[model samples]
Target: MTISLPVTVSPRLSKKASRHLKERFIEFLLFGAAAISVFTTVAIVYVLVKESWNFFQHVPLSDFLFDTQWTPLFDDAHYGIMVLLSGTLTSSAVALVIAIPLGTIIAIYLSEFASFRVREIAKPFLELLGGVPTIVYGYFALTLLTPVLQILFPDLPGFSLLSAGLVMGIMIIPYVSSLSEDAMRAVPMSLREGSYAMGATRFQTAVKVVMPAATSGIASAYILGISRAVGETMILAVAAGMQPNLTFNPTEPGATITSYIVQVALGDLPHGSIGYQTIFAAGLTLMLMTLVFNLIGAWLRKKYREVY
Candidate 1:
């Protein structure tokens, strides 16, 4: 009788239950985190789109999109975003010109050629640039950087896009260099050895073999760096001035979208006014542009990860 009753339950079934419970818990945790991030992102986009729609309801979409003059403070309104877009792109492009080559070169030296001691010293110094408060960079760009650039281009405007862009570039160098170095370091030692065995010089191996391997990662970092440059506000606000000039003159004062938002917020612009709503629309535009950059970066990283 005892033997007959014993077969109904087994130790295997108990262990299986425990493992199933643990796996479910882990799955729920992962799903919860992803859900939270997705929900937050959607919520933000929803708010921006909703508010921006309200803006467009009163101010025609065509005028907002096409008007050259960005005078949002008129009975006959022209909510042209081109001026703000111009400012954002100008600052980002200028920062890119300064950041890309320098950061990439430094990353190469650190990952491929620098002695251990030099890397130890330089890594901390570079990371320190990122930690410095953006507001401080703003102050420096306004007071010190503007003066220095003015001395070089004395005929140019003091608080110009060039000055803000340069400071923004310095701030972003840590981002690009650190990420690019990681990408470079990920190349297999065997590959480098293989190239060396082929009688290639160190420089040739680094330039051809290592760089090709790491190109995707480097491109991702570069795109993210540009996103940072585009989103920057304080340095542009303080050093680039609040003039939203839709021209490519780097030597002239120009305002970015963030700077324009700051200018609008600081003034006592009434709620529900075109001025108040314009910032939200501009913000939505900025968010969309940065989102595009992030998407491109992610794609590049996924593509180039194994090509080396």
Candidate 2:
């Protein structure tokens, strides 16, 4: 065979090669960014499960689940999750009741009816409301809302689920309204025009065509609102009294799972003690609850997802 000479790369080919290498490098960077979230999630699950497993080994799953009280810090040491769950559910329910309808109405107004000037003015204020510190909301709940509620209902306590939940609802309103408005606004203009062509009013078009087209996004907003309500800590801790009461009545003072965790985490409970381990167990439970809600959200998104 004849001697083979090394092929010389043209300037164009060299540039192309450099560009391809850069593209690969960029792809690797993007993948690393994506993987970071996955890694963090996995690590969190591992730690929670490992610590919670230790907790379960010490405390029977039956008592953890079925006991009526949650006095893990006391000498009696009851570990019923239901008490915390009840408070969480009650507060979340109250928050949802206030948030969903009002958020939806606001979203519809902003997306479909509000003038551009009004929308521009309102959105920044909504964002600012969301940007306010949760601790501030907690104090506001404690100092302001409770007294107002007490005025309305003489029996309402200074630290009540109703006050905490109401404030939480207000706090999460921007989350729901902002996301839902974006989803609604994303609907194609052609759909609105077609509805008008069909003699449908603006309200009708917004309600029927645009809403259906944006169901996936609106559902996502609702899901985010639910997660925010469920996971709220400071507001409940400062205002809901952290009593671990197993009552669904929002008028009563109670502790949510999150508030209890915060209490134990800040307390002088010794490491490896059962009382301390309770936080890990509670953390695991919260993660699972959030996971279930996420799965539900995924299902809703899939079920109502529009091609457009």
Most lDDT-accurate candidate? 2
Model 2 off-target regions past 4 Å? Answer: 1-34
- Models 1 onward score TM values of 0.89, 0.91
TM-score of 2: 0.91
Give the clash total for candidate 1: 1
Candidate 2 Cα deviation (angstroms), residue 185:
1.0
For all predictions, the C-alpha RMSD in Å is: 3.4, 3.4
TM-score of 1: 0.89
Looking at model 1, residue 217 earns an lDDT score of 84
lDDT of 1 at 236: 91
Model 1 pairs whose backbones collide: 213-308
Q: Candidate 1: where is the Cα deviation over 4 Å?
A: 1-34, 74-76
Lowest summed-lDDT stretch of 10 residues in model 1?
Answer: 1-10
lDDT of 2 at 236: 95
